[model samples]
Target chain A: MVLKVGILGGANIANKISRAINSIPDVAQVVVVGSREASKAAAFIERNKLVHASPVAGYDAVLDFPGVEAVYIPLPTALHVEWVQKAASKGLHIVLEKPIAIEDEHVDAIVKAAADANVVLFDGTMWMHHPRTAAMEAALQEIGPVWDVDSAFTFKGSADFLENNVRVKADGDPLGALGDVGWYCVRAILWAYDFTPPTHVAAHHGALFNEAGVPLNIAATLLFPGGRKARFLAAFDTVFTSKLEVYGDRGSLRLRDFVIPTAEHEASFVVATANGLADGDTRIATVEETRTVRNAVTQEAALWQRFAREIEVVRAGGRAPEYWPRIAALTERVLSAVLASARQGCALLPFEHRA
Target chain B: MVLKVGILGGANIANKISRAINSIPDVAQVVVVGSREASKAAAFIERNKLVHASPVAGYDAVLDFPGVEAVYIPLPTALHVEWVQKAASKGLHIVLEKPIAIEDEHVDAIVKAAADANVVLFDGTMWMHHPRTAAMEAALQEIGPVWDVDSAFTFKGSADFLENNVRVKADGDPLGALGDVGWYCVRAILWAYDFTPPTHVAAHHGALFNEAGVPLNIAATLLFPGGRKARFLAAFDTVFTSKLEVYGDRGSLRLRDFVIPTAEHEASFVVATANGLADGDTRIATVEETRTVRNAVTQEAALWQRFAREIEVVRAGGRAPEYWPRIAALTERVLSAVLASARQGCALLPFEHRA
Candidate 1:
């Protein structure tokens, strides 16, 4: 009774998730691969050596395939709304890749369709499922209420990538760098704030866009109630890094490899505790040390395993934990707010997701 | 040949620098300590064990004291311009504590008067003189053009301190947490940007103020030309921490104890390097390692030593380097812009200082 999963499109991310799914052989398997062109999908399966999966032409074929309980949609940002609705209609659960939808309205619609079909809908945010995330949360409890977060995820793409990559093309992934790298930054801040809505969203007034008007670089600040604030920076043309610092009333946690660990075996973060002012109130007395959390499998595999369990629950006629879709929808809501702020000349706007 | 220095006010920071100055008997000594009340100045000198210094009843007495070649003014923010001017008229070099003035306009005037008197005017920014700063600058070179910076300096103050501390009073330091702690945050960003003025400044909406309207918490963004930017967070009611990160085109640098080291004998920072994309572009390849920079004395002593050297040149009839004053003026210009943005309903404003 392996949870059969289908891969849609020959996206670069497909190879990684496919391998992750295959690793959890007893729980889930990549049962099929789908693409508009069958040859491209076949080439992708061959490249990743997905022996348990077969290739089919057209994305619809995967939705219609027998035993395909879930479809991992790695399609471009613009394609999620259509394919996800179709996949949900076919009663298949979803493992939609990040920037799940380009628009916030589309996010609610997509999630609602899945709920109507009684299928689990989960965004492919791998880090959220990692055991280290739980560890970081446990550490955060020592720090009291988190009031500040600073995060950055930037990658130095090839010159050709900035010029021609689908990520930077308005028609392909309209959110561009904001949709690509910034997705993690936004989620990290929201996670630190425990999913509470920010009162104001403002961009840093230094966003860069491609010729197609896709964002290449963006920086934004979110101000939550109770004087809590978060700032995030994302870029496609800058140095590669994933950094997060969460400061609370009593302590702080810093993770340099937050988005993706330097290695898959373990992840580490620094926790700093201070006794406050000392030495004539000129030097702050602080004690900082690193703590590591190790996982038996990679974070991506953990994500698949968790999603597979939810599918198992649904197959057994039990509930599929509704928080998954709720998190996805909330992340999309905040993501839209940041995009709106960036598009509106970096104006400060209220983060209102209710329609 | 020792540089005889006069201390203005019994401000908390004065104790630190007086100890710093008294440590180097060959280069400098605290010749006089001044306060509106003589007992307070005498107590400060006794507490800091400034054996060579005597107490004076008024600030003007120190400026007029025989053989006092320089004045270290750690008075409240509102008193700097008046005392600095009076001291300059007496041909005294000056080491003024940070948040040099309540307004940017006063910054130009203070520097202009110092230049006119041919006196060395160095701000009491201890970290600028630390050897770790030089090492950090050298490490930043590997990162290429720094495009982004994030820094924070915050302390969780007691209830009494927040209510009664002069820093929270409009007449004492109008800048409050911003002036007291954010001065370093602003200077750290400007230093990362090579003292270049930002084109725009905007503060986060989460700023908190005391009864006197002095900011207790503030967060801001400074946008330079070419889309380079920096974000700073300062607070009086948070877990104590001083963190800095500079991201450039090729790599990044992170310093946890950037404002004040955990230990005076040594300081450390992390430098991360990335090879851009890896694992089918799903994971970014990065390597981060920590580097330590040790100093023989605390940064405060180093600051006083550097300022004493400048005073030595002035006393020797050689021209003092003018860049120190320039950096101080530039930092004040940016600091005022952040406060203005915070006050103007957190509006985004141009960072203009030319008047």
Candidate 2:
């Protein structure tokens, strides 16, 4: 009953997923590692200690592997659309890395291909699968209608990373920070609003660009209907910060580590319910409640487990879940709008769904 | 000799300042309470237990009180210019409440009057005098050039407040939340950047306006030269939160209560120095250090003490300090630009110094 998974590249992120898959034996296991060079794939498997997985010379071999029910694509951003469509054509489900593609059209193409093949597709935003996320969602619901969300994910890149990382290269990542860290912020915001898209997006000025013209640091605000708004800051040029705060009419939720919890097994978020100010006091007092959740597996493993569960449902002749690809598409659309806004002098760009 | 201070209009905030003045008997003392009705002023004095201060029938009577050496003006927003001018003409040093005036021209007139009378002038942003502010500033320097500053100040308003508070009235505190809570966020941002004005400012959409068109909640971004930036969120419709985060190349500073210390005597901030992530890690490892400062006096008392020191210097024939008024003007200018940007469909407005 275990789902056999294939990894499509030797990217560093693949190491983490390989380890995650190795930890969850009953749900799923990575059985194949694919790369242009078999030796590189073997090295990746060895370094990550994936003893059960075998290395293959090319991605196509992984797609064609008889036992591979799903493929985890950690390929560079430029290679996503082609490989995802090919995987779909081969009837394999997908666990795609975030910033699923450089642009929305590519995402549309991949999504359409997945639909055509009736395959389960999910983006690898691991935090979305964490139990803490569910707890936060329940807390937000208790807080009343959310009116504001602020999130940030930033980390300082080393000199070598700035110079040679695929993220800073125009053809490699193209979207750079917006596609990498920004993906998490955007997804978290959307999740806070139950996958509803904002009506308009505006980039804040002072976006930093790499030599290849990809954004290295950026910030933007998303305005939804009914005065609901969200803002996010994503950067590869600042010290590490991963925080999200959601404000509701009656309360608020704040988490210091939203993208990745400080501990693998435990996560916490603070909820504050408004108590209004005491008589003649300048500040309003609130009861701050901290909620903590413990998980038996890492968030990445949970993500893999969820993907496997969906794949099993599809294998049983059930329809592929539409919600996964829908959110992925929405995340891509908002990111593209932010980039467009940044390029056009931080203008407010109306959100339009192309797919 | 202690500076003899006069209170104007009997605003609720004046009670805090009156207590601050009473606490520092060797430095300054409240001598008079002024209001349209002598009985109301007397009631305010009795309620606040200011036994040494006498109540005056009118604000001008407090200004003309022979022993009044200074004035603390907490009148409604629309009356700031007139009272400040009269206080200056009486050759009294002045401690004015924030949102010093509604517009740049009004601030210009106040600054001119203070200069013409050669009196010390300061805005009543009490946190500016806290020892923690100095400690945080020193830590920011160690963190290197600040490239980003984020601050927020918000408090929930009661039904009575939303309906009857002067802040929501068109003719009372017309600037509303921006003038009240937002002024603190803007001041903190400018202070973090050493009062260097940003090059441009833009308001985010979703600014909530009252029936009289006063902002109840707002967010904005300020872009400085060299890719440095600041952002602020101010609201009267959310749970209370006052946070400031400053990011630099090497480190960052985070304060949960930047506008007001949670405790009167002790305040703390966290500083994180980037150590670079371990190889193959997703986030940079940081050394988090928390710094705490203990103050013998409340921030309000510290503010009054600082004002007294400045008045002492001016009384000794030194010129009034220009830095105080200069920063006040800059904060107002940026606030005005944010309002302008918010009105113009969130357009990026170029920063200009009208003073």
Candidate 3:
């Protein structure tokens, strides 16, 4: 059976999802596109040449479509809580783009509603579905117990994404850099490091020049229960770069240019190990192989296909994995820490968990 | 009046002092050069082609050099405490290389002897001599009360400086990274943030390869009194990279390529601040300047020349600044935390000052 989806906002993410849904094998169909203005939704369909769609105004019309079984939310951050709750009430499975909500209460409501409705709910964190994530993780494990995890994602800017656009809003402000890129780094650590919840979270965030820079760059450190620690940095106004290195006892695993992967190949962390104590006995550690994929485009396509597989799991009368709620909770937890640190101008310790 | 000096080792630092002492107008002769091996000392003298008398064989020869009122200790990590104490007993003022000792006892003895001798003792942390340090600090002050300071120093291994070489033997051992590059990054935070001594210490360290492999890297966070925090990453088995960034309420100040600076001149940090809601103007608060030095080598030369200036203060018979002991004490304190974390693989809270 096909899962017919209605996109609730005509945003860039909607375009990406339309492409993804079109590519996935008989899993999802984008039947309707809705915006506050009918012309806007119609324009999106016309521009993308989306053949199968009902151009509608307001979210209710999208929900009223008989074939729409799931809702793909690409609305402003502030609208997530309301729409996700509404979609759940209408018995629609949901895919909410990160951050899910700007405030904790909004996230709380959405999480509780999804739990009560017993429906599939996932945050559109694309990298989690990337094939290379598993390969890089397995390679890291070969090195043994991880001692440190560090990540960085930096870029000069996205001028094209700006220019009086959708994220440029009053109360519907775009999430800060931490909310955007930092979330990915946080997820990368979560996935690699046994999905441990951070015991202590400390963060530093700052604005940039363009697009009402919402904490465009942030640096945060998460301390786990064991002496294990992870540090991450995300930025919009820095030179283009992203890397993840997991330093372990026996060796280390590194993914250079992680967030913005290169085409046709992958990079590995150069390893070094001791051979023996005798003079001239030492040797450079072996370089293990990592799963090489194409660019971010292919990685994204691979993940969306996997997510489409999970749609079958959702259809089988069970439930989507709790990974989505857990990720939602963690993102909120980290974002809260960043805000507290920003307001206080000092490290916030014993970070408050979402009750 | 000249402040006569004698050298006890032929390390690279000793070469730097030769140049500084030769160039300074207030300096005297390079009276003596001593090493455990006579040929090695002679080779150093021949390489520099100095006017000093023949290179001496025993440690005592330099201790007994005529008119030598001060000593520069640029020897191996383990040997620092012994020489500092011996030099102190002989009433010789000293400029000690960093990691004053690989072990706490070594630092304790050096601190005690310096106090007992009523003579000047300085750690050769020459990066402090860079004018930009003061500039960065001044900018930090303007930003508001600081909450976090992040620092890193990493570089590819120098084949010539492999583990077990006398200079790095102790530091290249299982937990060596804690005392080697780790000390500098730790000190940068302690000094930059002026954080109080920690009450507890925890660390996580492991072989970049295995136990027998050299400890090539360390990542640790220190918690100070009153909720202040500092985090750092230091390594000898990665790319040559260094950075120092301080986060405050109003904005942040960052210095890129810190350990080994770049010729582009000024190190930069983008200070981000949010405009009022009405203005909707958020941008980097600009404060740009050029470093003006060629590279790390030239920058290092400038640092030693500044070290010579401190000799002027010593010549005046004044006590060294209060910040010195605090900086030294914090280094040992944080290193202890790093070691503890490495041993236990958990975040150690509130590092304690060693007894």
Candidate 4:
């Protein structure tokens, strides 16, 4: 019942999934690694210790590999639309990396391709598969209804990376920081709101763009129905910071490493509930409790195991869980609105259009 | 020499300063309690056990009280213009409770009157006086130049408080949540940004208002020079949550009880610096250290001691600290821009006027 997976790129992130799949050979195994150059793919396989995987010359070669049941597409965001559709047409289940596409239409096209092909299409947001995410969400019920959310993910890119990295190339990442780290910030907020889209989105007035017009840093505020609000920021010019906080009427929940847990096996979130009122109205005490979740597998491995399950369902002629692609589409559409708002001096963009 | 202070209102906050001054008997003393009704003043004196203080029939009488060298004005926002000008004219050094005035012109006027009278004007933001505040700010240097800030102060108001309280009364505390709790959120961001006004400001699309057209909840984003950004939220319709986080290029510092210290004698902040890189491209570890500051007296008492010291300086024929009034004016100007942006459907408001 092992799913044979072909990896379509030799990107650095591919090393993560390769290790994950190899670690959980019973659930999934990497059978082929593909890069524009065969030598790079061979190097990747060796570096990640993928013994069961072989190198292939091109992306299509990986897709055409015999017995390739599913393909993990870690290609640049700009290439997702074409490759994802091609893989879907090839009848291979797909694990699309984050920011499935730069344009909204492309996201719709990828989702439609998967739906038409009846294959699993999961966006590779590793943190979503973490057990601690669910545990934190469960604690939300006790905090009353969520009224506010704030999240940020920022890492200072070395100057060389900024100059030579595909992420800063307009023809590649295009969405830049927004598509890279901002993807997680957006996804986390959506998850907090139970996948509900905000009513309106507006970027901060100071979104920075690289020389190639790729966003370097961007921040936005979203207003949902009932006055609920969320703000997210992502940048490539700050020290590493990943945090997500969802505040309800009675309390709040926070995690320092939300996009990626600081530790591989153990993750925790703090629940802050109000307590003792200081004698003066100066300040009141907050009762904080840290809840921890320990998982035997890395979140990436967990993601692969779950995607493999989806592949298993599809292989058995059953429908895969369609929620993942839909989540990706919703996330992309909101990101589109944010980027659009940023492009236009932070104009307000409504999710739904009405006269 | 003790500074004799007159209390201008019998509001709940009066109990705090009364106790603070009573505790530090040498620096300051509450000489008179004033209210519209002499009986309420008497009741306030009795409730606070102000043995050395006498009740006065009216605010003017307190201003005229013999030996009264200073005044604590915790009047609602709407009344500040008249009383602050009156107190300054009477040559009484003033501790003006926050949101000094609803209008920018009034804030300027209050500052002008204080300057003309050569009397000290201090905004009653107690947390500013905490030693931990200085400790936290000093820690910011190691974090590198702050590029982002996020702060919030929210408390769920009881139904009765919303319905019957001055905070929700348009003619009384017109700014409502913004003036009351939002003052802290705005001040914290300003503090993080080194008292520099943002280049532009924009509010979130949604701002809730009570029946009297008083804002009950608001959130806004501020964009500073060099692409640095800040966002703040304040609400009277949510559970108590006061947080301030200043993020720089290298690290960040956060306080759970920024608006008011959780403990009267101690406050702490967490400084998180990046550490161990996770094996995968997953999240790296963060090194967090909590530094605590323990004070011999409450922050409110510290506020009184400092203000009383200013009184001492003036009594010795020296000039008072001009930085404080300037800080209050700058905070008010930034707040004015934020509120203006909120009123105009989150329009971008610049701090300075230009072509």
Among these predictions, the greatest DockQ belongs to 4
TM per candidate comes to 0.97, 0.97, 0.61, 0.97
Which portions of model 4 show Cα errors greater than 4 Å?
A275-277, A353-355, B275-277, B353-355
lDDT agreement of model 1 with the native: 0.85
Model 2 agreement with the true structure over A1-355: per-residue lDDT tens digits: 9998899988888888887888899998778898899999899888988777899999999998878889999888899999999999989999999899987789899899999999999998988999999999899888889888899988888899889999999989989999999999999899989888889999987789987899999999999888788999999988788889998877889987777776767888999885444434533345789999999898888998888888878878999998999999899889999999999988888998654
Sort order, DockQ high to low: 4, 1, 2, 3
Error of 4 at A95 (Å): 0.7
Determine which window of 10 residues in candidate 1 chain B has minimal summed lDDT. B275-284
Using TM-score as the measure, name the better of candidate 3 and candidate 4: 4
Q: What TM-score would chain B receive for each of the candidates shown?
A: 0.96, 0.97, 0.83, 0.97
Candidate 3 local lDDT, A1-355, one digit each (tens): 7668898978876776777677653666778988999999999887766678778998889988877888889788888898988998987888888877887778888988887887778788766666566666676667667656778655444565444444434355456566666777877777667777777766532223234545655666677666566778766544334557666656566664455444323423343332111211111123344445434344445555565666677678777667777677777666766656544543546766653
Candidate with the larger DockQ of 1 and 2? 1
Q: Which regions in candidate 1 have their CA more than 4 angstroms from the true location?
A: A275-277, A281-284, B275-277, B281-284, B353-355
Off by over 4 Å in 2: A275-279, A282-286, B275-279, B282-286
In order, candidate lDDTs are 0.85, 0.87, 0.63, 0.87
Clashes of each: 0, 0, 26, 1
For B1-355, candidate 4 gives per-residue lDDT tens digits of: 9889999989888888898888899888898999999999999999989988999999999999999999999999889889989999999999999888888889888888998898999999989999999898889998889988888888888899899898889888888898888899888998888888778888876788877778898888888888888888888887777889888878889987887787778889999877435766665776889999999898889999999888888988988678788888877777778788888878888887211
- Give the per-residue lDDT of model 3 (tens digit) for B247-277: 5655555554455444323433444333111
User: Ten residues in a row with the worst lDDT in model 1 chain A?
Assistant: A275-284
List, residue by residue over A132-229, the lDDT tens digit for candidate 4: 98898899888878888888888888999888898889988988899889999999998989888789998887788988899888988888888888
**Residues A1-355 of candidate 1: C-alpha lDDT, one tens digit per residue:** 7888899898888888977877789888887999888898889888988887788999989888888888999998888999999998898999999888888879888888888898988898899988999999998998788978888888778899888898999889988888788889989998998888788888876788887888898888888887788888888977777789898888899886888877778888989876555777556676777899989988999998888878888889987667888878877777778888888877789888553
